[model samples]
Target chain A: NAGVTQTPKFHILKIGQSMTLQCTQDMNHNYMYWYRQDPGMGLKLIYYSVGAGITDKGEVPNGYNVSRSTTEDFPLRLELAAPSQTSVYFCASSDVDRGFPGYTFGSGTRLTVV
Target chain B: AQTVTQSQPEMSVQEAETVTLSCTYDTSESDYYLFWYKQPPSRQMILVIRQEAYKQQNATENRFSVNFQKAAKSFSLKISDSQLGDAAMYFCAYRSAFGPRDTGRRALTFGSGTRLQVQP
Candidate 1:
């Protein structure tokens, strides 16, 4: 079903570089989230959208931005990429109204900032 | 703020044996949910099991089960007949039942995680 798809599975960026991580879901879920996993740590929410046109910052939102213009797409933007931003990013979608049992996560985008 | 804690940073078990990964959470809300997510080398977060705070009965899925202690806010996962595929980093997560309308967001607070190693 292509639950959730994240583009650029792997990337390398130099300092001060900015890039966008694309995420899309065919499930048409209203709830979508972006999370980053640092080494030896659990995933931390970066940003989330309850639905298109409604977005909010999450626990770790610094240096990142997100937009939800359509139900199928939620993209994460990394500005001024720093070594600290070197980590794996995951996009997840869930739907309480659709009776989704739990979240369906994307494979993840592994980014390295050197 | 709600928080999840996984005391065991790492655990290992012999193949075919059983292993338990412990998780405890702190929350003031009575209605909430708990989840166990498995992340192998692939790093894809897979839900292992889930428990509702209001439900007294624990949740189970095949060889995986959770011991839900609502009073203690403790949710531990039990893996039976462990195999090589069972080896992964297990994470405990918490989410509130009510999604605040003001922000329109209900997010999961996850524990650091427990690395599970299955010995052959």
Candidate 2:
């Protein structure tokens, strides 16, 4: 169903290098989120958007940026990547009206910053 | 701020047996949502079950069920007749209630997660 798609399943970045992680969902859901899961740790929210043109910082947004210019796309940008940014990134979406607010997650992007 | 906790870092259950994973949360709001997500070795996160705060009746789906205690602020997942497919990292997550402020609450708070092993 192409529920949620994330580009570049794996990547390795050098210190100070910048990159962007792409995420798109075909569910036409209004809510989208970006999160990173560290080794042996649970996922932590980085940023989220309610709809096109609306976005907000999440728990761990300091080193990341995101924009929602369209309903189906929300991309996270990492400027001047640091070693601490190395983690598995996930994109998720949810349609609140679907009766349950549970989210559908993408396969995830395994990013490694050395 | 809402926080989710999964006390069991690892669990093992023989195939065909039952196992329960523990989860706890801290939240002041009365209305919220809890969820269980399973991440297989393939790294795809799948929703296992969900529970609504106002619903006194526990939420169950096939072999997956949740014990929801509102007063105690505890939510746990139980997997019955475990299968090899059940071996994965299970995460417990929580979200704030829906409303105009829903945008702010849209971000889910996740616990450290529990790795479930199914022994055949």
Candidate 3:
């Protein structure tokens, strides 16, 4: 079903470089999120979209931006990538009824900023 | 802010044995959700189990089950008949029931993962 798909499974960027991480979900869910995970740490929220045309900053929004122009696509932008930005990025989608069950996560994008 | 905690940084179990991972959370909201997500070397986040704060009965899936104690704010995952495929990093996460208006926009807070090593 391709529940959630993220592009550029792996990428290496130099300092100050800019790139976009693409995420799409075929489930037509209303919620989508971008998160970054560091080694031995939990996933940190980067940005999220409730639905098409509504985007909001998450816990860790610095140096990142996101847009939700369509129900299936939500892309994360990394601007001026820095060494601190090296981590694995994940995109997840979910429906509103998440009383306890609701999220489908992507495989993740591993980015290394050198 | 709601917070989740996983005290175990690492754990190991032999194949066919049972293992339990502990997680505790702090939240003021009475309605919330707790989850266990497994991430393998492939880095795909897989949902292991989930528990609703309002539900008194714990949730179970196959060999996976959760011990949910709402009064103590504790949730633990029990994996029975563990297999090599069960080896992975397990994370505990929290989400408020009063999430954003749109379901897709809610943010999840996660605890540091516990590395599970299943030996043959």
Candidate 4:
């Protein structure tokens, strides 16, 4: 079902440049999240949306923005890329069912700000 | 806020042997969820196992099982008959079970992960 798909598996951006990491899920999940994983570290939530048009900042939301225009898509935008933003970004989705809270994760996008 | 900790930064297990990865968490909420994820070279997060806080029986999936201690706030993943394919970075994550009242609190809080090396 292509549970969750992230675009541009790898990319390199110059300092001050901007780009968007795209994420889509066919599972019709109501909750979507964006996380970044630094070297030898676990994933840190950057932003999350409970549903379309509802977004909120997460643990590490600085230097980034997100928009959930549709239920199937949640895109993360880096307005001014910095070397500190170099990390593996992941998109995940899950339903609101009380029975299970597990997430379906994408393959991750590796970004390097030069 | 909740936090998960993986004390072991790395671990090694000989093929066909068993290995356990330790994870501890801090949370004030009684109802929550715990998970172990495996990330291989491909960098795809795969759910290895999951345990609900209220479930007394330890969650087991094939050769993978979890030792969940509610009182101790510990969740360890044990891999039996370890194989080369099992070598990867393992992460422990936590999520509070707050219902619709707490909409955005459902995000999983992850630990710093333990890299598992399956030695041949």
Specify the highest-DockQ model's number: 4
Off by over 4 Å in 4: none
Q: Write the per-residue lDDT of candidate 4 for residues A1-114, one digit (tens) a residue.
A: 668999999999999999999999999999999999999999999999999999999999999999999999999999989999999999999985687776899999999999
| Preferred candidate (TM-score higher): 2 or 3 | 2
lDDT tens digits by residue: candidate 2, A1-114 = 869999999999999999999999998999999999999899999999999999999999998989999999999999999999999999999887435675889999999999
Candidate 2 C-alpha RMSD relative to the actual structure? 1.2
Model 1: residues >4 Å from true position, as ranges? A98-101, B99-105
Residue A104's lDDT within candidate 1 is 92
Worst 10 residues of 4 chain A by lDDT: A94-103
Residue A63, candidate 4: C-alpha displacement in angstroms: 0.5
Q: Give lDDT tens digits, candidate 1, residues A1-114.
A: 669999999999999999999999999888899999998898899999989998998999999999999999999999999999999999999877422247999999999999
Q: Which candidate, 3 or 4, would have the higher DockQ against the true structure? A: 4
Candidate 3 structure quality by residue, lDDT tens digits, B9-82: 99999999999999999998898888999999999888888888888999999999999999899999999999
Error of 3 at B66 (Å): 1.2
lDDT of 1 by residue, B33-68 (tens): 889999999988999888888889989999999999
Better of 3 and 4 by lDDT: 4
Span of ten consecutive residues with least summed lDDT in model 1 chain A: A93-102
Q: Of 2 and 4, which scores higher on DockQ?
A: 4
- Clash totals, every prediction: 0, 0, 1, 0
Best by lDDT: 4
What DockQ does each prediction reach against the true complex?
Answer: 0.60, 0.81, 0.69, 0.87
Residue B50 C-alpha lDDT in model 4: 95
* Model 1 interface CAPRI class: medium
| Window of ten residues with lowest summed lDDT in model 2 chain A | A95-104
Q: Candidate 1 has which clashing residue pairs, if any?
A: none
